[model samples]
Target: MAPACQGVAVAEALSIGVNYGQIANNLPSPARVSWLLRSMRISKVKLYDADPNVLRAFLGTGVEFVVGIGNEAVPSMTSPAAAQAWLQQHVVPHLLSGARISCVTVGNEVFKGNDTALQAAVLPAMVSVHRALSALGLQGRVNVTTAHSLDIMGPSFPPSSGAFHPAALGHLRPFLAFLSATRSPFLINCYPYFAYKEDPARVPLEYVLFQPNAGVADPRTGLRYDNMLYAQVDAVYAAIQALGYTDVEVKVSETGWPSRGDPDEPGATPEYAGTYIRNLLQRIEMKQGTPLRPATPVDVYVFALFNENLKPGPASERNYGLFYPDGTPVYNVGLHGYLPPMLVSNAARQ
Candidate 1:
């Protein structure tokens, strides 16, 4: 049977979803923010956490949500009781109130670092959460999974020859089996911009930016790809297939280009960011699947909603937002949202 999540064909032109990260101090409240997303007709969202205020605001709005369980909470989630309590506190109330939640990511990129404990707890947390959802009669309705960084892929070149790092395979094998058994998607954070930035000389600027360019060929699959994003996605599919789990689905949890960067950061500009998103939106709207999975449309949640001023690291780390805190478009790709004008406008005015 086809995955239930893939059965619904989101109206491509108007169905673009954005990741709503709240790491910054200046983001608009969830209530006003609801108006902004509704105005753009965005019916899907992915949150880094199950924020109560955000959940309450989007209640009855018909926007489907993909909430998260932070890495710090992974250890707690390993226990079925703690997982149940967390659901009761963070998820159950919202679902009862008519929030359309579809997936719950257990942790974000737990395998990318040296946190052995977080990595070990990842799958168990997912299992406990899945069991809790089942006990509550919500398993079929909500998926349990985790997102991983592209760094987990050992070699992502040639699209079809993708393979997971040998080190990650030890942990990933059991994780994939869990997803296969439960029918949840395997989320990966794939960013082609990193390749271009790391090796600008070899990586074509036009290709990474989604500009017109002669594409590369995957010798094994004999498929030609015009864009790096598709190639990266296909590579992931290849990697997954190599693991003997062809039925498992792969989804992109984060992918975007920065609009600004430090002096040394090349290809980080408003023009490239706009171009990349516009082209990406166009492709996703076409319901275009990767070369490897031609029958399945790519599932994605764009990197971020707003520039996170408090985010550490390089300048580019904070500029991935499509909008500013004041509900202004950072660089237009014809999609913008406004936080609610008043905190209780929806509850009070409506």
Candidate 2:
């Protein structure tokens, strides 16, 4: 068993999910992170890979997980034997230990890139993984899905008139069918921060930050959207509905603002990041839903748990984390964690 860490008490019951990316060389050990998350009352975590160390760390913690298979592994999942072997090795052992893994995302943003082969293999890979789960009698308990980039949408402004890009239509049609048949959700990485950064002049900071503003009205639906995140989500719902898929639920797989960025990157500061996350937490605590799906509460996983130093991209890309590697808050959004000193050495070895 992993050594126990000190747990800091948090007041609010964490209603939001957070992405636990491990792209950094300087991250705390999974055991330590588990304690931190538990301390903060964050019950749900999304991992980009089925890292055994992480799955093992959370055993019996009752913290639910959404583990993933990376893009490079997508092609291999097309083979039934390969999929079964992968799952049995990486996932089953943890499940047997009482790990609460609710979903398996086959690939992350496979459609966003220009890789046509990866796009073609996505659905087949998902089907194979789902079949493997069924063979093991874990189908319904563990849903199989993949995350998509917002680039898949053609026109997303008027939420009611949202539609998928024509280039993506061919792949999405069958993908939606698979989701509907399996009763799984459509995971989307919606980044309002990207929109604001792209056109800060035109995009109101208040709108994206969930601050008070006049808000925008969808000309067709007549629904008022006070926040761009909700508008983006509703637009996705509209796009999904347009493709004759009303059954598949929409979930935000990733969303967050960066605490720091290059000079060119607008609205990227500690203040803006804290405001965005704090306000988002408030809305989530109230169980607020998108205008389109008012009854079905919006499911969102914040972009990252720790600022990754190794990620290759714009400065903002590596600055989305809410905490530093030492478990210190990058900017206080009312969340706190306790990283045991004993685990600090363990984390360094990793």
Candidate 3:
């Protein structure tokens, strides 16, 4: 019933990472959150940025982190000096301080939209960051990569025949080459809830929720897929392989369900959200892999650690957390842990 998305006693070391997003004001301090995660046995966390406070709080906790460079910072990262300086200012000190930072994402979902300039800068920025890492003698030790949105794919159905959008190909081709040469993972944010909300009538709720159904098969590979999450992963693998790079590993940088939403957002209730997460947690516990690659279990980071009240999107966007800002769970999904209240300093305690 434990569901912190972290692995334990598995030979493959297969673990699930949780996105420790901090876009809310009422959440507990990073120190207390660290206690909560370790209590639940989660050792991997992904952050939207390299916040020094969070990094410092988790010092010596042994939780591996995958930090990021926001879209606004991508163009600047294209410069080698800027990349190195940024890393030194944000990442290096933490590493020296015993923070286990395992990866640096240059930019996030650059190809998901039509920002020509930002899209143009992503690969160069990645290259520059990677070069800076190598210069610092930490190339393979800390990978350089980016998280992508599933919208980058042109046709993700059927798994085996997936391909990147033609326009995206111009950028992805070289990006894949960089990832291959540098040995970094291709990260993607896959959300099955969007698919169900878009067409709940046709997209059976059980399938998206990971319940037992007839499941579909890829016409080419004839692989049966009972859930949309695995199919989305294999489709990404197909896309990467189509680009002629079979060696690059694809990781789900973000995936989760919203426990609450606006009236129009169908199937966004707490019950469905709990089901989606619970089922996914079960699969991670079993070390389940996609039908296409049984040997390589799908690496995932559940969308968030807590619901961010200030997130600027649909209600669903702000409500994707497994827990709320007050450190209380929004919905029960088999996993349970305690989030201690804020610690009092000597002056405050007195």
The lDDT values for all models are: 0.86, 0.90, 0.87
Q: What is the TM-score of each candidate against the true structure?
A: 0.94, 0.95, 0.94
Per-residue lDDT of 126-207 in model 2, one digit per residue for the tens?
Answer: 9999999999989899999999999999999988988999999999999999999999999999999999989999999999
Task: Please count the clashing residue pairs in each candidate, in the order shown.
Answer: 5, 0, 0
Candidate 1: tens digits of C-alpha lDDT, residues 22-130: 8899988787777777767677899999999998987767889999999999999999999999999999999999998999999999888999999989989999999
Residue 167, candidate 3: Cα error in Å is 1.1
Q: lDDT of model 3 at residue 296?
A: 82
Q: Report the number of the highest-lDDT candidate.
A: 2
TM-score-wise, the better of 1 and 2 is 2
- State which candidate has the highest TM-score: 2
| Deviation of model 1 at 234, angstroms | 1.1
Off by over 4 Å in 2: 1-12, 343-350
Q: In model 2, which range of ten residues has the least summed lDDT?
A: 1-10
Worst 10 residues of 1 by lDDT: 1-10
